[model samples]
Target chain A: MTERAIPWPMMALAVVGFAYMLLPIFVVVLAGLTAGEFLTFPPEGLSLRWVAAFLQSEKYLSAFFFSFRLALMTMVVATILGTAAALFLARSNVVGKAALRAFFLSPVVLPGVVVGFALFAFFIYSGMGLSRTIWGLWIGHILYSTPYVIGTVGAALAAYDDSLEEAARSLGASPWRAFRKVTLPNISQGIQAGSIFAFIVSFGQFEVSLFLSAPNAEPLPIAMYNSLRYQFDPSAAAAGIFAITLVIASVLLTNRLVNIRRLLGRQQGQ
Target chain B: MTEATAARATGARLAAPALSRARLTWLLVVPLLVFLTVFFVIPVGLLFATSLNPQTIGQVTVTSDLTLDNYLRFFSRSNYLLATGRSVALGAIVAAVTLVVAYPMAFVIAKTAHPGRNTALLILVLAAMQLDMVIRLYGMMVILGDEGLVNQMLRGIGLIGAESSVQLMYNFLGVVLGLVQFALPFMILTLVGVIRGIDPSLEEAARSLGASRRRAFFRVTLPMSLPGILSGSLLVFALSISSYIVPALMGGFRVGVLPIHIFQQVAEGARFQFGATIAVILFLLSAGAVAIYLRVGARASGGRA
Candidate 1:
């Protein structure tokens, strides 16, 4: 209730912390504008040549499109399945509901490296062909991204009053109609937020895609990884700027649709 | 109505239709359950199975015969053990550093009276979380490289000779810096939520009792946010240890950690068995941390269940 005086040390520490978080991103964007061929802090000359070059390259362009398509597919599938699961769990009196919730969220705890390896081995053992590796990557992305959707939608549903649905059912409305008209409209923001999160996650996913990607169908991260590994250039910084832009755009969009703080602050009960 | 009459009425109303409603609810979750069973649960099971299977040298195939050869080899090899040790140490250090740096920022964001500043800070943290890991690592490389930003600034300031710069990249320090930056946003956001939940009255009450600001914070605020600290540290440690891109790109293969080691074992050597073993180890380590955090959280909540 009282206006507390901010300590000088705390203020200094907070500034330094923000600088630490933002400096790398600012440096990368700055380097991408360099006219010089190599990555550097202060630009020899400012130009968007590297960004143009990366955008024009056929390999990078295709990787960009591939990542886009995969992310779109992942977003659609994860949203539907995760929303359905959340609806059931949130509305029903299911036995072992806590256990089921934990199971759905287990991927959040599972290390990405392990998930990559496990899914890679599973695909191999199942005799999946190279052509189907994209599908394999999609499945992997869905598994990883679905938990975010479920979490958001479940949080939204927790705040929802289920009696509205019951009232609709008590009337002439069918269960599906009641949900379609009442429930879906109420949680649309959460769904949109979750979809954005899912899309961003799938777009930037690296660990699982690193293993599951076929030789010719590399995602953007895998392509960037390969390029960085084999050759160091300012073009990678250009590509990084693009990635950062996409993330910023998505986060801002999510913030517009739903309160980003509420989405991220979700803990067990609160 | 009496409690017994109300309960009996509810029971009578629900007995006939409960089975059908339960069936519909079960049906709704069936798709997810089946999908996870095939995609997640089975694959992890197969990964465990593969870890147990032994591989013959120069052979692309692994034998189904059960053996601990993979685990034995991992333990016996000094390089592998060293990598695991370094990973644990690095994870701990990153978690600790991020916690220290993020606590004040979180406190300011949660407790500040200025709404606009808090919103801006929250957005920054969220944006940072969504940034791609590979891009962030690349950014760190540019900042920490020999002829990079830090050295460039230092040299221009006349603190160091033009011919000399600090060795910041292609080493352990670069990897640590990248991982800490990568994990800090998550820690801050988590701590913000926890810190906000603490009643401001409690801290004010402590202050009213003649406690200094520092003492109030140390005694009340810090102790109250222990759950957040535990969960955030565990999350950061697990992420830091499991990270591959930061170590591989920033460390320039100079730092060998468990994830990178497992990657090499599989990618370079085509030793799937060894990769699986390392994966299993990493999985258990992270899962163990989660288990411990859960136990502590349950106890902290005074065993609610």
Candidate 2:
């Protein structure tokens, strides 16, 4: 700990700031658990009725599971591609390296809505038969999710010790084997954290799915959006409860697998 | 061996391996490069082309009769022009407010040297960021709605009549508040790094030299952390302007920002050319902000950032 006292006024300001950040979240969770018919805060009384309703509702349940499947698919592909790109970036002395890195991460810098619309329009023109299909949505998701994997894994690669892999190579192990043995183990935690993040991001992705989602099979966020628009129901809050649960679970899981602080400390800050 | 002979020999050996390594690494990145080009760049490029086309519904590709009708329409229409302005205004407001709300939090987090307390603080920030925007904003609905928590509290405290309820959500103010809430974590995280990187002794030196604590912070530490403040606000600006969900939900479709306009035109109205027009404008705006961010970031880092 530092020797400084961190003035009380600053601490008080911080507490208020934190309360502002947390107020909405606290309200949502409590409202979801409320026994009342409509969403309300300071719960009229606590129960699992909304959760049960969410689980049983065909429309919400299907969308939730569909989102789960989509996230799974997005995570797998983004991990492989993003990890490969990050590794290449770290190891290669390619020309215009900075430009290339910028290009790879550019999809995320644009609004997700733009990316979704562009892809939706592209699919319509290309005659690829992917428009409004799950394939188009998946592609959009991959574009959105891969940069995060790159960010996290790139942080891991930056922190990794290179000499250990060099030592393995010097001991006559094959280059691939040396990488698998020394380097993979070291950065595997990063890959795991990144992939999990990809899952979380894709699962919660709302903007991109807004344009690309299939009419018949709306993703969870879009479903909730529609529900919230047309009807005010606690089940939407219940849906939020699950989304928040996934977010919390992913954070805890990532913290366990890697020093999340180090990842944030890096410039990538995915 | 003599120095000259050894140098020549090593150069020959190193050159071969160096060339091969570059080739190998380029090969490794090719797949991802191809994937993004196919799926990302081309699509956006097509959208730009579509925006240039004449007002033709269901036309997703460029045509020979390319005209700037969509652009002209956007420029000519008061609502669209006003939306463009509103989008910029909202982004700037959100960025400024986020800076104010987040700076103290970042300061506290950065100065808290205790590992457990710091970790807890960091976790709260990260968790809030990771929580789904839709889910988190649902909480906003609960808090900021007419009958929401804030209004209910005000009524309980007799600040207003029992019959009155202030309209917070479904308006510009709600969008600004939601954007600020969404942006706080990012601004805090960015500033925390810079603030922590600042040397404590600099402030101590000011204090030792007879400056008040506040004076030292304002004169020394605050100036030093300007890079973070600038970049974080720029980041927040990009996020807020480009955001679709926050404005859509919190504004309840009543706030016609650029993003909301794009969604209404393209997704709901099927006006692809018009949507693409608004999108291109939005893209240029965000791109301008990002370009500034890159410049400021480079200067801040004293190199690549």
Candidate 3:
């Protein structure tokens, strides 16, 4: 390869661009770790005092737990619904397949705030008593998260060869059994990845949570936004540290199980 | 290549189960279809319908009567007119800036060749992307806030007095910066795919024909990657225009974009009709952009998309 050495100019530009992307994160982590009371320049040295405070703080803890609980619920439902849809999209000769795929993915394509507000208005108008309730919030999270699961699982199904399942069926395996034994194992990685994404996206979601969160129970993103808006809180940065940890842990876990780069290709215009 | 892929697709379709398997699989999609119709389609569709209703605070149901009053008010009001212009400008600006900064990184990643390094870079981008928006904005606050690193450094270098630090954030500029930061990973990822897909032999052929490296890049590589640029920019535009958190946090409630207007009108004011009108305009704007993106993308990929 004649291009052994990347031109110094281009490399320098890369460094600058990377630094630009990374600088704010670095600042936040350091601020989260600061020993000082206020979020200050130089971070005034590193410590875990704020993180400890964050863990002990009642309001923040409750929000954290609520977020965790909501995300777990979102994960379970989204995984099931999304995986089933992915199978249908991949294997079935459905009418207007392209249009159906687009319809399924539209939740992701639409802005989160739009989805949130529309649902909020709907619940209020329809008068099924879902307004500003935990059930309403649950519905919002499911709507937002199911698309990500569909995307990941759909990608997985596309990559898998369906012939193996067909072969199993020809050898006298039932339709469900062929899927259970042959197709399921092959695409389980996608299911796992999809569920993890569901958990993570639901946890970090702010826009939808802003409109749909029930009274007296705020999601962590909403809580953090209020904290930042009204006052400066190191505990907020500490909360950030925890969110980053969740993202990193799940990403590494997914990477260990599957080629995340290939999944990333699904995020084309996302 | 197109013919081969088309044939493979048709073959795969032919190979699928030919019996009541179709009925069974269609059953799988029923839940999602019903779920989306109830929560997604009907809600969003109702919102569009509500936008046509005249301004009515605390009105839950769409009225039988319809008028253009809400739309006219939005069009007539200078405050709203300015907000719409500002939102579009912010999106356009963020898309341009993110593209320029992300291109170099995408080019480097696409050409790295080493699998380990490429994987590492990809993972890094994915992690940054997955990082929660609230947390990521917290980072932005630390650097762009008053007494932040930039202002502190500026003061240290005597660019400004301690009492007169530059307002780096809590304005339109801050929102732009936050959005660009948010959009960088997306732009980079979109470009790397297209850039890597471009045949190296074409560039090599240009180089062998007495062209410089820069000339080869400009003539062959850059033109080929145009699709990625347009796609990424369009995506970024839709994202920035519809974004609520960035402006809310970065602008400190001062930057009044369409989203902020909608939130204030509906969530806070309980003014459903006016809020729905704002949401409709926003939905249309982004939908137009996405419609263009899908069309352009399909043409670029020879209708494979």
Candidate 4:
């Protein structure tokens, strides 16, 4: 492809814009290393003491574990259900296809606050006890993340050829066997991409989780929020850095699994 | 006659599999539809119902007596009305700002020939989007705090006195800044897709037809990207209006946006009915905007919803 000259102004803007996006994250990482009790930039002395302290804290550790478990469950359930729905929609001449698609995807457009509030009220009205809050949270996260899975898997299915499944069936394979051996492998990229999105979204979910979480089962975001609210300490910065690192790692892993750009861009089914 | 009867029976057998396949398709989708209906749709429906339900304040009781009192009280109170208005206005501003800043970057990412650069930019935006909101807001607080990096830098450059620093956090400006940062990646990603879909050859054609670069972009590129702009803005606006953490943190719990108000009513005040009312209002506003956008998009593209 012949390279076209981009305007210098646009290049300059891109650099500035990227820096704007990244600078806060960079600062948080830096702040996490500060030896001072309070958050400060260009630290008086740099050390890993804050990170160490945050890691040693049981509160943060438990919150991390809870969030991890929640995310895993959400990923598994959402990926399975969403992939099935995507397969059906992509292949079948289902009536009300458009309406069904919108119904599944509406959570994407629905406000998180609304979802949180609604779920909270629903749980209360149903007399689900505080012990069930975790389940409530799980349900909410699953609902929120399923759309991402559907979008990715649907896009993948749209591009996949039905002839391959047909070919397998013609070769004396059962429908289930054809799907398991052929179709599944072919769409694994979409499934993996969707899983990553679901996991990340579940892990970082705040608004919905906030409403559902009881005192003892607080997720990482809520823990972090409470820490920030009650204390102005650098430990919060350390926690922030930890979360950022995890997100960056997930993004890198996702990039390896599939073209992240395409996954995000293919939401319109094109 | 027996041979003809056998052939007819075989034809019925041949049609069975095709009929079952269609049923199987519905079966595959049933789990998801049922899950969403019970967990998502019903809960939200109940929430709207709760908005109209009668409430006994100062106690945890809700009556089945239908009343518009909650909504009426919501609008009658100046504070609630102001917050609702502010939230919508803020959402609009954030959407506009995010689009303005993201468009050029997205254009570059979409048009650039350097695959490496494009991938790097895409990863940056993706990573940013995946980052936790609480963490990002914390980072923003540190950078925009009274004694934070921005202030320190300005002081070092002799822009401000030693005791004086800009009030970057704990106000409307701070909330807007945090929201814009949060919404940027989404807008950029959406716009990138739209921009990439537009044929570069179209711009060349326009240029060859005696159009300047700016004119070519305005006439050919910009108009084509309207769908992206609409959808992106709608998403950004909806998300921002529903945002709770950013405004709560950056606004120091003082800036009473609709979500925060709803949260306060529920969490702090223990008033679920009032909270539900605000939530219903907020949901309607954002959902209405999105519904309108979808209708327009469908009409323009002659596409299904």
Compose the digit string of candidate 4's lDDT tens values, residues B1-305: 99999999978965675676678777898999789888788888888877888765544334677899998899899999899889988999999988888888898898876777788789989889988888888778888988878998899889999899999988999999999999999889878878887878898899888998778888999999988899889888988998889998899987889988888888888888888899899899888877765665565345422
| Winner of 2 and 3 under TM-score | 2
Clashing pairs in 1: none
User: lDDT of candidate 4 vs native?
Assistant: 0.83
TM-scores, all candidates, are: 0.94, 0.96, 0.95, 0.93
Model 3 lDDT tens row, A48-137: 999999999987888898989989999999999999998998887767886787778766656788889999889988987876776787
Query: lDDT by residue for model 1 over A167-198, one digit each (tens)?
Result: 78657576678889998899999899889889
For residue B151, give model 2's deviation from the true position in Å: 1.8
lDDT of 4 by residue, A1-270 (tens): 542466678778877887878888887887788878765545788889988888888878788888999999999999999999999889887678876777788786777888977877777777775323678889989988998898888877877898898778667777789889999998998899888889999999988787888777788998889888866667767877777878888888878877766676666433
DockQ of 3: 0.65
DockQ for all models = 0.62, 0.65, 0.65, 0.64
**lDDT score of residue A28 within candidate 1:** 80
Question: RMSD, each candidate, Å?
Answer: 2.5, 2.0, 4.3, 3.0
